[model samples]
Target: MNPELLIAFLASTAGAATPLIMASMGELVTERSGVLNLGIEGMMLVGAVVGFAVTLGTGQITLGLLAAMLAGLGMALIFAFLVLTLQTNQVATGLALTLFGIGLSAFLGRGLVGQTVDPLPHLHFPLLSDIPFVGPLLFRFDSMVYASLLLVAAIAWMLARSRLGLMIRAVGESPDSAHAIGFHVIGLRYGTVMFGGAMAGLGGAYLSLALTPMWVEGMTAGRGWIALAQVVFATWKPRGVMLGAYLFGGVTVLQFHGQGFGLAVPSEFLSMLPYLATIVVLVIICRNPQTILLNKPMSLGQNFRAD
Candidate 1:
């Protein structure tokens, strides 16, 4: 293969992986706080439709992105109310949320079929993007790619250095202990969950508004579920999530290339690469529950009672 072709391949892999990276990182935060949100798929779907619809109406990609975040946060708040306030089963509530999001998006997006929007424009740095093989591979990408990198760096800084990050970790490890230390456990959980939802929503929006630039039912496929698996694959670490996202992204990009290379594989099987990679990574990580338990939020799926 040509060197330029390899660079392009890697670039496509990163582009494909960006959404997963965003969604998985968000879920990592949520799970770190001891909340397992299974409705991620639903949240992403809602964000996709809502973001695309808003962009179509307003012709502002920024507004569309904001709308997508808000939509996702709205859905997350509903989950928070049910599981946190009403004390419902976390898993069941999450599944219900996913169902609700899917139904709502399908109903609302009927008119958006076959429509298109101007996706975010790619940013090319002077001289940097013009470099021979590395330019196309590294420098030419939309703002979302940079945002994903920034998110990873920001998350690492927060978790490793920031006071608020410590508090979040405390909340996840043991809400009771965190409460004793005067941390607003409920507030922290709610905030993190909402943030996670927004990220997931942005990830979804990236697909509809940026990647494909069109609306389709079940467009997210199982990316949300894959994102959930990524949290586990990362062992609840921010950098781990980034690596896992790229790994999955590579699988995604390779599937398309596999067909081009005429590997004689079924398209369905090729498409399963990302999900299959997710499962394999999950199994490997879960093999050491003790290590996972150490980093996992102590109260992560347990409801808190003010008593």
Candidate 2:
């Protein structure tokens, strides 16, 4: 591979992986508090459409990103109320949320289809950006890309060292015990759920506002599910999520780049590459029960009532 090609591939990988890292990181924290949210895909779609609409209306990507987060937060609130307050089945509620989000985004985006906006500008380091491989690889991305990396570092630090992190883990491990210790398990879960929604929304915003600067139905292309699988593949570890997201991102970029490099595989197969890889990773994870059991939140997917 040419050095230039290698650099370009790595750069694109970072761009592709940004949304996954941000969304999964939020989900990681939410899961750490023992709440299972299947609504990320829905939330992401909501964010994408809302973000695109707002940006198109205001001509400000910043405002669009903010609206996207707010839109996702709104969706999370609904989920939290159903699952956390009314005690709905977490799995069913999550699935329903995904469906709702798909429909809502499609409906909302109907007017904006085929519209385009100027893509966000990449950040440039005057002196450092010109340096060989490191410069292009590290310095050329937009603010959101760099922010996602920082978010990963920040999340890792918080989970590993912060008192809040310990409390969240305790809730996930044993909610009853955490409650007996006077912790507000339900409240914490709500907060994390909202956070995850916001991050997922931000990821969706990245897709429409930065990558393509256009609105299209189902543009997320089920990346939300990929993010969920990422959390599982990473076994709830922050760094693992980053690695898995980028690995999958590479697979995503590969199919598009593959034929260009003389890979004779058909276009249809290339498009299926990422999802197929997701299934394989999931199978590998299921095959190693210990890997999951050891790291998975003890009370994951279970609801608790204080009555």
Candidate 3:
């Protein structure tokens, strides 16, 4: 009810939503090229561990972020090689990637467990950050938070207004047509896949280096899956993805803020709110077949092989 309270809630939602925004946005581009990557969760895990380890070893968050992206890129490259080059089942390969990421990250992170680092600092825009209601709400967040918003805006612009966006959309709709027209389908898809991997890795880094600021084996806790679902729930649109992310973030932050409002509940139930909301939203979006068909990528999840 209070403006300050609302601002705080919204701010928390932004923080909570950052990783999902990054991950889903990445998946969005990947799918825009007609490739479904179910390995997002695993990739995020790898990013988390790699990011934490690098930061721990070097005490440099920037390098840590870079390492995470590279690690995620490696994972994506493997997926692309298998599914695109080798023509493996996209779904199955994606699942394998996820499993490998989970195990590999845990194994690699074994020694780094329990260690912590200083969380990313929030940026303060002197004059702007001092404004009454707008300051903290808009100008006081870490670089990643701002970067996530900018990334969304950039993606929306690129997908809708840019020529490259048109090419990408065309490829996703019909890779055969794209290839026949002399647009290197495989090359384009590879680039998108690597970009997706990089974003997923950044999401993982945000988790370890910002949100929790520590390495806990499998710290992602299914957020990657939620991000994947977000892409579908958003119907492959960047605007929709951002909205869904914040709404989901709100659900996530509610449990923490509930106690202050005297909304007493079991901790377990409170913790389940976010995931529960996710299932509910998915069912809502999925129940209507027309909605799915209206915006669904025609060639999504299908392998494109040049004959």
What lDDT does the true structure give each of the candidates? Answer: 0.89, 0.92, 0.93
Question: Model 2: per-residue lDDT, tens digit, 1-307?
Answer: 6788788878888888998888899899999899999999999999999999999999998999999999999999999999999999999999999999999999999999999988878999998999999999988999998898889999999988999999999999999999999999899999999999999999998999987789889988989999999999999999999999899889888876786577899988988889999999999889978987778999999999986
TM-score of decoy 2 = 0.98
User: Which is better, 1 or 3, measured by lDDT?
Assistant: 3
Q: Candidate 3, which ten residues in sequence have the lowest lDDT sum?
A: 258-267
Q: TM-score, each model?
A: 0.97, 0.98, 0.97
Q: What lDDT score is found at residue 191 in candidate 1? A: 90
TM-score sort, best first: 2, 3, 1
Model 3, runs deviating above 4 Å: 1-6
Candidate 3 lDDT: 0.93
lDDT of 3 at 57: 92
- What is the alpha-carbon lDDT of model 2 when measured against the actual structure? 0.92
Supply candidate 3's per-residue lDDT for 115: 92
Clashes of 2: 0
Residue runs of model 1 more than 4 Å from their true location after superposition: none
How many clashes show up per model? 1, 0, 0
Question: Which candidate should be chosen as best, given lDDT against the real structure?
Answer: 3
Instruction: Report the C-alpha lDDT of model 3 over 121-150, residue by residue, as the tens digit.
Output: 999887999999999989999999999989
